[model samples]
Target: MKKSTLLIAALMTFGTVKADEGMWTLYNLPQAVYRQMQSEGFLLPYRDLYESKDAIKNAVVNFSGYCSGVVVSPDGLVFTNHHCGFEAIRSHSTVEHDYMLNGFFAKTLADELPNKDMFVSFMREQKDVTPQLESLGYSRCGKDQQAAMVDSLQRALTDSVRQIDPTLHVDIDPFYEGNRHYATVYQDFTDLRLVFTVPKSMGKFGGETDNWMWPRQTCDFSVFRIYADPKTNGPAAYSKDNVPYHPQHWARPSLEGYQVGSFAMTMGYPGSTSRYISSYGIVERRDAENTPRAQVRGVKQEVMRRYMRASEAVRIKYDSKFAQSANYWKNSIGMNKCIDSIGIIQQKRDYEARLRQWQDSTGFLKGQLSFPLLEKLYARRQERVRTMMYWRETFRRTNEFSTRAMQLATGMEVKGPKKNAAKKYHSFADNSNEWDAALDREVLSVLLKNYREHVDARYLPKFYTTIDTRFEGDYTRFVDYLYTRSLLMKKGAKLYYNTKAYKADPGVRFGQDVMDVFYDLNEGMGAINDSIETQERYLCAAKLRMEADLPHYSDANFTMRLSYGQVKEFELGGKPSGYYTTPESIVEKMNRAAHITDYEAEPIMKELLSARDFGRYTDKTTGQMHLCFLTNNDITGGNSGSPMFNGKGELIGLAFDGNWDSLSSDINFDARLARCIGVDIRFVLFMMDKWGHAHRLLREMGL
Candidate 1:
């Protein structure tokens, strides 16, 4: 009779459990989930998966804090997505020796290229800390205060650990939408070096055109090795004396390929997901966040594409930047489309109605978790949020001059000896070679004009007044004037830091004006944002209580998680989409490269792929070299380089992407449509042996 009663009745009549769903934490995987995994063909014992020192979890590493990777050899050889190592590749590339264009392979350990600020972290352990935090009044603290408390706790834990081992690090992150908390211990190895990579033509094969799409042929892999202190065999900084790290455990690379319905699993750090978000939050993400991001980045990327095509130097400098921007730009577009097509907002609303009914019937968190309040708050902030997204995409790191000026402007605010020290360290020459002045000037003018036209007049930076008054409302003229007068535009310029002169400089003034707008927007939305966060947390708590009978996994926060599924395929356009792609697909795409440049590859690629004598890399069943495959494993952004393993825990491939039709998986996981895209391990080995002739490294892996 009552809504809550109806909710219960519906649950009984139609079960809500879905298979092949969840980014499950390994330390405390639910017994029920494990049973389901067993049904799906998981072969290892529970302890073998997580508890033992030789567990596969020990081999997974947080790749430079952005992606996932795995140790695959006794020599600490690591494998990750080509795009994961993109910046390192770009940093080493030059016109004469372009590693990105021609690829790189270290013939000897001494030839391995060292990267600055590159480190891989091995997660040692994770445990719940909610009870401890709750005892210290963490549950009673307001949303604004919890962050500081967590930070203090984390620092104390980290400092205590460093006393014993300086290489160890600690992170305390909230889970289940802050209803639970866990502390993770990690050991970091800082000295990482590039070992092998395929050229961009092969590594980034199919490029943006095939990214997030099915039937992918991209190899999408790169190799690196970790170095440790020779004496202690512990983490160390780069030194000639450092030796190759002999890890306690590593994944065995399997040439034995997978078949449709074969057991598949992925273990790695997934960046973030909003599966617990309310319907109002979905609306906000769609209209306020994804919409503006897609629109602004599309305009910016076109400008970058034009310049990059015109010059090889510009292309090399901006390749990494362009790829980063383009990856998410298309993601936003696909996410929005999937959100609408899947009717995710409507589904969430229906679930929220049931949750509200349950709360009302039980009088549990009835007043605290108010859906109406969430709707009102989101409605009030939608315009400001959209404007903020536009502002961030338009100016934030899009223009080199503006980014440097902002740094100098912030540096000017410090007082005392620190102020002078900051001035001494400040130099425009830092990374000055990464950007072209002509490209930057053009980008500045285009984004400035676009920002003014799209956002409200009140949101415009103060420099717009200078343009109107002095340059007769011409963005190009104003940008040219600033470039001509500002020392910040000079490649090797030094800052004098005189208050009057610094304030009067057009570059600093522009940066300060932009920052002023940013500060104002943030300040105005501070209370509103906090209110929204509080509501969302309570909503999550209420949902957990209502669905207490169901097994739940926490939302991903760039921590290690394992997702299990099968090598499976889905239907597209009323036809079955195959689970794997072959070299034939690669050749077909290349043949059409004249119309679709994304398919263009090195001339050698065609010959190598077309070869009939493919040796052991060829699949025995299909008698073809598989380029990529599909699995139903749950994954997200930071799972880019995650290892996809067969039932025996042998590495079969590296997870690189998700199908475009399931782009809304971040907010809503659709078991029917969602699938993970992985580059086959054999494809990686084929490239290493056939293309690069990397026999020494292959022998090290015992292949």
Candidate 2:
């Protein structure tokens, strides 16, 4: 069948949810789902819950467009994951002042440090525009044509919105596999500064040891503030004269303790989920997509971990980079296990059988050409998928130097007809000064080793065989040789770029070779991906048709969503795990893991927790400080640092991680097994007030 025929085959990956199976858009939530949430203990009115002037939705902002954060104090003090602000902290750190190891706390306005590009986007409004897009005849349009149509409409909407107020950041986002679209409006504040942060010992507490594992105690919270132009009280770029912003809506944190049966709600941008992808797609991911990522990052993480453990300076240098690398490394491992352990693929196959029956009964397509397109498309492209994934992970992702090389080639292309590096041309390149010689060399060698071992002979760069034959596949020698001769290495240290030096750099030269091979593979893979994507979108539209009148929820696309569930526990390995943990656990875990730097606690934190200094923030029920809690509230990647709210919409905790068992839920959610891990608001108070002793900030928060 022609690819155009598959355009309507998709809606979502599975049947519509009757209960807690959606990352719901706050603006147009189904009344049925709202009532379901109310029955489950949510007390907020639907209007106040979503569309009101001062709704809880207004309090949450997309932090730097990468993670979710909440406005806490009226002074625009923002709360998000410590790991989320890892870049800002890392950039400011040095061998002399190690903010990553010993956290920075701003006691006064002048003490607050400014970040250049870090900014927060508050989505002021969202309006459904699916009907408008449908008017353009989307069903008859090709994929590229459809994209162009959507882009044109989106640009017009953004321009009109800007005409009213140029300060507003406008973006039109697609939902339900582009079957639905929304014009999401935002007010972006460019001035953000460091307010306060607990030490890594407190913020990163259990570290990678307990990353995705439950029964957790990690105070994964950080504090930042938005600064506005003094006269206008509006968004502005970084200025020493700017004052702290007073937001229209900020969350009122409640100290009320919650248990297994209490209601929980999360409002933030959840990154993405294939939630309704086909069974064949599941198989492709199970075998191809996830495994290579684990392999490549695992190698890079180990080398960095070793060097970081060896020195405090190296630890400061690579702490944030390691956290970013190690997060998905563990996630890949957990997700792969969950896929098999839960028999998710088999479940998808079974559901597809039901879908077939539904199609027959509903006469959705008249059962023509729609049946095995998904299966056959993936089957034909499976090898290419693996090849592309491996090439992507190994060359594009793993080798940091590869991108530096790509910049060199692209800079030359932009030079156009000049054909010479001697001419003064603007090369817009950023070489991060965060690199350490030991870490980068080790990472490059390992990535090159994997690329040689795994990628197809034709696709593999010629430089790989050169290293193998000349150096006997000794990655260490090859990297050492490459770095020693490369001027980019020297220039990269000073964070400067030289066009001729970039072209001559051996690292960039090899990077160019890798890119050449990649471009060739990507050219062929491009056609396959186009066909597969068209099939997937068509599959989603067809599923929507099969369901007809059911309440369907859109897939997550890093846009704001509201997910609700109760604070419940589930059995793991025949053991019924409890939903809460205490400060006592941190003390115990620290002493036991003292040998590992990641888990090692500061002497002061240990002294206090060991002394049972629970203070006034202690929970009345447990009579101990609640460190963390578990809820069945559905969450994913960008949901990190999202404020977890009680029935009254009071901030109670910060959603941080998901359990290992539910990792497969991104593709298939098992409501019983899927649980969101959060750091209790009371725990944050205790750490900030008693541990850090920032009493002035406490009074500002009305604690």
Candidate 3:
């Protein structure tokens, strides 16, 4: 879990990678994006009226939807990604009737289905937590140890608010990487309900093949509404009696067409991307890491997909798993495409060139920092980097039993009298409630055996998984020892998982003492993480690297980040790139494949065929439709369903995916093609109104 990578260059030569003006640091936010945000009305409403609570709520409330929706009335009716609201959709779906397949609509308020554990984030306010967080000195806290400090600080800060206003919930988020933090207070209304969605054929549109591609055609949207209790103000489960939330503002959809370079703000939880990483890391990831991983995943997907087509039972068993794997498979390929793209690579070189130019002019930075330092550092660690990559690819294994064993041993430490320790332990136990104790034990046993087979022999001398142990020892003994000892802890252990074991254990008591030996083994592993030498030489170096790079990187935590840009006509690979798109560009690509006729009916196609209308979109130089924007907004994966808002706060477009050419742009901002492609809000509205005949919904929003 080191957030940063170490790649260095020498002191005098030009490095392959560089950071430049085009790569605006988030630390200098006030000078760049925030200024645009303010001009565009993106700053939270009620900036001064409410206390810190108000500011936080404004942010949390304004959070963009992951699905497509519109304000049906003065009330907030947000639309966003269907897959974004897939869980809510599934809650109402049935075996006899798949809502996702058929889609759902709310004929009246009474028909909406309420969902549990579904909440929206509204930003309340932001404050400097630097001093408070810094109180936990960095020297005293190693990279791994900082998680505890952060948790404690967050809990303490959140508790202060809860004591005063029980309705408020707090979540801490990091911006500009881990260098800064903010506690976001939310009016967490769990009473979220489904309004309507198109059938899979319409909602999914293109399917997997066209998912992340563009110049697209797909109605990738769904509708959801928030419900709050009338009297209590607390979030309530869905009920016909509940009322729709009255939002601060709503959007007016447009169809007149907007020119490129319009100010845009994407308000959503963008998943992470590594926009700030060492150039050396990018090379390794592209040429060696991602390419290979993609190959493996691609092979698996093909075999599984073929099996699903050939056998119904096999298909049913593996369908979901395949879908999950397909994302990685597709993403890997997208990344590879980006890494190999000449346009992207040129941008990387350009950024470096700019840095060199700036260093020469700045004078103060000339000798202090240069591109060569990066290259030299990276060169020195080439072997170590490869070794680590090998270990990651070949040696890592998630042994359930080992994890459980560690938790069980650590459970004793929670029994201490300290309030924080007890509370922390209690929370940990609560979170583990979903785990199946028996299955976990069994999985652990299987995993250990698998690890022995998969790991390389070269790593054997360093620690466990040695060939001698495999030949001389009884491996299952370790497994049995864990189970037996875990049984004892269940007797008096207050932890819920421990409690479950007590009820299940037969209490034969044989070999129970062996649990103590397993505990020692667990401690030995912990020592690896806690060792001072390891902290200084490896962990600390990684931590510093991450801190230095975060300002320029995007978080790829599978969350979401919005990349804002207009469609632009450009030249690439000796050809005019006029909004480059392929047959595989539809969101419902599978459907297009299934029904070729659908492509003939697409709006973009219709325009293409009706040369007079569509030709208007052609760029002057590239002779392609321009979908371009210029702004300093950062984005990443989870930001897919985010709404790209213009300066006036009107919905301009729906961010769907990034171009394949700029995949490495996440690690290094490559403006040439790193632009976020969105289905123009005009398009979303056009589909809903013109295509879907949702005029009533449109008029309600005063459009």
Which candidate achieves the best TM-score against the true structure?
1
Off by over 4 Å in 1: 1-17, 412-416, 419-426
lDDT of 2 at 155: 83
lDDT (tens digit, per residue) of candidate 2 on 405-494: 565555532432355545543333444455667777787878778767776788888787768798887889988888787644454232
lDDT of 1 by residue, 70-113 (tens): 99999999999999999999999998899989999999999999
lDDT of 2 at 639: 95
Which candidate leads in lDDT?
Answer: 1
CA deviation > 4 Å runs, candidate 3:
1-29, 32-73, 135-140, 143-145, 174-177, 232-234, 283-292, 307-321, 340-567, 572-634, 686-696
lDDT of candidate 2? 0.79
Q: For model 3, where is the 10-residue window of minimal lDDT?
A: 11-20
lDDT of 3 by residue, 1-703 (tens): 3332231222111112221113222222323334333443444442322343322113223223332233334555666766566656655665455675567767666777777667665444345575677777833676667677777777887788889777676666654445555555655566777877766555555557555554455556776777767675456666667787775545555444444444555655555555434455466567556655565455445545565566544443443445555655677778777666554455556755664565466453334344565555555544433434333332132223343334444443345456554233322243232233443444444444443443344432222432236434454555565466544334344443344543344222212222333333344345432332232233223333433432232344432223333335434465645443322344334345446533323344333323333232333444433332223344556665666665444665555565555555566565555556565554455445434566656666776
Instruction: Estimate the TM-score of every prediction.
Output: 0.96, 0.92, 0.63
CA displacement after TM-score superposition, residue 265 of candidate 3 (Å)? 3.1
lDDT of each: 0.90, 0.79, 0.49
RMSD of each predicted structure:
2.8, 5.0, 10.3
TM-score attained by model 1: 0.96
Question: Is 1 or 2 the stronger prediction by lDDT?
Answer: 1
Candidate 1 versus truth, CA RMSD in Å, comes to 2.8
